[model samples]
Target: MCRLFSLTSRDPVSPMLAINALNVMKEGHDGSGVGLCLRGLGGPFGEMKEAPILSGIFTEAGLKRLSQVSADIGLDPKYSMTFTPKTPPPPGTPKRGTYLARAFDIPDAWKGLAPEELAREYTRFRLMLRTTGEEQGDMQVFSFWPDTLMVKEVGDPMEVAAYLGLDNKDLVARQILAQGRQNTNYAINLYACHPFFIQGVCSMTNGENTAFIPIREYLASRGVDGYCGYQSDSEVFAHILHYTVNRLGLDLEYYKHVITPLTNEELDGHPDRENLVRLKQACRKLVIDGPNCVIGCLPDGSMFMCQDRKKLRPGVVGGKPGVFAFSSEICGLNAAIPDRDTSKDFQPMHLDTAIVRPDCQEVTICSQLQALPHLH
Candidate 1:
């Protein structure tokens, strides 16, 4: 199993808090890798929310490739910033050639497109870069979204943070999702790390995803331009959220229903029984079957955590309005939000979904998908 930590705050905060939390629960994860994704960026990126930011690692050769591709595609970056560790990575740690966070100006031709269309374009561009980088095995692209940065490395969580200069750097954001991966089923591949992102949605998981094959096949069949990568079974969670909201135009709550729909016996008591029955019948392939706990963030800054119907995985959701935490263990939350009222912390059941939005007073628990609330 892996350890997942996330925070949604009204103010800018560093991910060190989350890393510290993960360290306390170190026993739960093997620390094969660490994945971090931040939205509602603060500090240098806070004011550049309107511009698209590209976050990744690039070699000297990779830099030239990026510039050539961007210019060739008419998506030149307006400004770029790179972060390297103040000190070298701990001995034996895997290091990146050059860590970067760049902001790009949307080309005039694409500026007129709708937000969803523009997002798809950016997704295509990111995938193109990934394809190019594969030939060299040096460049690794995490995310290319507006006001968001994603960085992942194969090493101990704390050591990886230091390698990225996470503590000494000016990296800050209103929301962050971090994971310490314990490689149980797969090789130590960087792309297989958690805290996966697609377009504006981000997600990280704490348990195995046994239903990955069917889920991957179902998603690939949809022909979504950005749904091809299956480096991690958990990546599908982020894509599922994107497909539910962007492709189906459904409310976020429906995401819960699609991924963990109620059994026919349970649905018999639902108020929206007819519609839900139709939904389950149509999208049953998307249902995930396994002992899993997932934490995710949406474009609107809403953060959430959910568990499989079996409830085999452990999780805790706590904190007050301005801040709430979703972590794999109580000690993780205590480390992340020591001052918050943890006495009211609750563990979600198979039937519940926990959500927290910026400035929200409390974590909203939705017991049934039909009653799920919307942040907007």
Candidate 2:
């Protein structure tokens, strides 16, 4: 199992805090890789929230190609932060080229486009860069979205964090999702790292996805450009989320129903039973059969965690009024927010979904058994 750590605070914090939390649960995950997703950015990025930021690594040649592509696509460079490792990478960690998170102005032609249309353009642009990099073997793009940044590398969590200079104040964000990968199901590919992102949705899981292929096929058939990559089985979780809330125009709570639907007996006499039944039938292919615990963040900085119907994996959510963490282990929560009241900490079970909105003030535990307010 991989160790997952996610934190959202009213104020921006360094990624090191999440990395340190992952270190506390080090025993659960092999030192194979680490993946981080930081949103609700602060510092320099805080002011540039309107610009889409591209996060990834690039070689010298790749960097030139990226610039050329940006010009061809009409995206103007606004700002950039590049890291050239100050010291040699630790053992088992491959030497990489420049690590970057650069923000770009939307093309003038796209300025008048609708929000959804612009989002589609961003997805297409990011995929083009990813494909170019993959074919040329020079670039590896993780995310290209506003107010979001992703970093993934192969090595121990702490070591990778240091090598990438993640402690820098400029990299601070109000919300962060970090995973200590175990690499039990697949090889250590950077794209396979956890905390997968598409458009504005991001998610990471702590257990094997037994229903990956069916879910992947269903998502790919939707003809969505951003749903094509399935390097990691867990990537489907994020796509499923995007499809549920963005594509279908459903409420956020519907995502839980789509992924882990209740049986007819369980839904019997429920307030939305008829709608639930139709939803279950229509989205059956998207249902996940898991021993999985999924933690994710939406476009609005809302953080959530849900367990499989069987509750086969462990997860906990706890913190103070201004900050909260969703972790695979309580020790991780302790490490990230020690002063919180342990008595209020929640361990969501099979039918529960723990959510923390952008304010980061409190955790709302919504059950499948209860009718939840519609959330976009």
Best by lDDT: 2
Candidate 1 regions with alpha-carbon error over 4 angstroms:
369-376
Q: Please, what is the whole-model Cα lDDT of each candidate in the order they appear?
A: 0.84, 0.90
Candidate 2: tens digits of C-alpha lDDT, residues 159-222: 8888878889788999999999745577768888999999899999988888999999999999
RMSD of 2: 1.2
lDDT of 1 by residue, 185-252 (tens): 77666677888898888888877788999999999999888898687788899999998887877776
Candidate 2: which stretches are off by over 4 Å? 374-376
User: Ten-residue segment with the worst summed lDDT in candidate 2?
Assistant: 367-376
Candidate 2 clashes: the total is 0
Highest TM-score among the candidates is held by which one?
2
